[model samples]
Target: MSVTRVELAGRSYEVRVGSGLLEDVAVQCGPLLRKQAVPIITDANVAAYWQEAVTGSLTAAGFEPHFLVLDPGEATKSWQVLEQVVDWLLDQEVERGDHILALGGGVIGDLTGFAAAILKRGCGFIQLPTTLLAQVDSSVGGKTAINTRAGKNLVGAFHQPSLVLADLDALATLPSREMGAGYAEVIKYGILGDHAFFAWCEENGAKVVAGDAAAQEYAVDQSVAAKARIVAQDERETTGTRALLNLGHTFGHALEAETGFSDRLLHGEAVALGMVLAARFSARKGYISQDDAARICAAIGNALLTTEIASLDLSCRGADLVAHMLHDKKMDAGTLPFILLRGIGEAFVDKHVDLAEVGAFLDEELAR
Candidate 1:
């Protein structure tokens, strides 16, 4: 097991990455779980695959496991489901001292963490992220949120998890498409901060998605470590240091909205294409070379992810897409900050971005 610590002052937590961690979940989380009844929130898709292992672990440890299995999808992260989860947690008689387990992918982790955050003003929650995207990005950041009509993750809080167990065994059950989706976030870490890691990903991404155990562990561990270092520096995203983590999210969220946030574009797939757009946009702005931008796109394409907005077949124009971005959570003082690349692994926040120019750029991309 590789343990990466998110070193937040007075509230630091460890993210443990390894195989068979789920089977040993009770032992892994035994210290934080204070009561007999262990509450786990998961989506139906995940429950079908992982519920037994988690249940067995907790039960064997003399703890009664209670699962609130929800319908899986992006739509699950909503006010309605949030209300259901909060009400369920209340019925579980959970306390601030006790830790609630978020046992599934990013959706489960985000919803459960948000529920724990607002429960009795504040409570503890552990992240058992079953998906690669969650393990590498969402699960570690403490950025708990639910999508609102206004925009994605517009209504959310920075509620850190007590611990995170990223069990590799869960990846074994993931479909190839889901695995590719997860790889987008995995590569995002490399693209945003570490050039060497980006090169490594370029070489090993296929193996990682193909369920190569060593490659998956390295990718997860490296990605978690990269995120942990940043989170420790700016736990609340106050400094621009942490904003680099949004390297592809701004563009990705807009694509998500354009697609109705459905299966048509998975969050990771949106992000994959978003990074491509960001890179190309960066090149257009003279921040990065065209060759470098092409390299970035090539790496994304190598992972079998969508690398072009034109391929999405949206009826909207560039201006329409930018209209969706106006609702982005990162909007400030009527300006949206973009994470543009200076080069591979060199991302910085550009707050003075012109939305009109962005619309024009999208127009070109849409036409292409």
Candidate 2:
């Protein structure tokens, strides 16, 4: 087991990553097991694979496990579900001193965390992320939110988890397509700031995707560590440092909105394609060379992710994509700051972006 510490302004938490972590979750979280019965929120899909082990572990520890399982999908991250979770937690009589366990993928984590954030003015929560995307990215940085009609993650809070348990064994049940989407976020760490890690991914990304234990642990550790360092410095995103973490989020979120936030485009898939678009757009702006742009796409392709926007078959035009982007949470002073790359492993937030120019770029991309 490998543990990484995420230090924030007034508090810190450990992100525990390894195999069999779920089976021993009770022991790992024993100190925080304040009540005899622990309340957890999960999606049905994850419960099918992991609920038994998790419940068994807690049972062995003399802790009763209560579960509120929702239907599995991005659609669950809505205001409707958020209310249901909060109401259920209240019915369970969850107190602020109690920590709720979020035991599923990104959707579960985001909804549960957001619920905890607003429940009784804020409560503690633990993240038991099952998907690679959640384990590496969403589960860590304390950023939690539910999607709104406006855009993705527009309504949320920066509520850090009391603890994060990323059980690598959970990946064994993930379909290949899901694993590929998760790899997009793993590669983001490299593309944004760590060139060496990106190179390492080029050589070993396939191994991680294939369920190689060592590779999985290393990638999770590295990705979580990178996010920890950044979150520690800018917990509230007061500085531009934390925004760099949204390397491909701007374009990805637009794609998500265009697709109705459905399974048509998984979040990680959108991010993978978004990174490619960010790189290509950077090249268009003369920030990076064509070769570097090609390199980014090549790496994404190698990870078995879609690199072309044309493949999604969206009926929307570039103007439509830009329209969705106008709802992005990153907009500042009516200007959307885009994270662009100067080269491989070098990403910076550019606030000088012109929406009309971005729309023109998207128009050209759609043509190809």
Task: Please list the Cα RMSD from the true structure of every candidate, rounded to 1 decimal place.
Answer: 0.7, 0.8
Model 2 alpha-carbon miss at residue 23, Å: 0.4
- The alpha-carbon deviation from the true structure for residue 314 of candidate 1, after best TM-score superposition, in angstroms, is 0.2
> Candidate 1: how large is its RMSD?
0.7
User: Which 10 residues in a row give candidate 2 its minimum summed lDDT?
Assistant: 2-11
- Where does model 1 exceed 4 Å of error? none
Q: Give me the displacement of residue 240 in model 1, in angstroms.
A: 0.2
Give the range where candidate 1 is weakest over 10 consecutive residues by summed lDDT: 326-335
Q: TM-score for each prediction?
A: 0.99, 0.99
TM-score for candidate 2, please give it: 0.99
lDDT of 1 by residue, 225-332 (tens): 999999999888888999998888989999999999899999999999999999999999999999999999999999899898989999998888889999987788
User: Candidate 2: where is the Cα deviation over 4 Å?
Assistant: none
* lDDT (Cα, 0-100) at 160 in candidate 1: 93
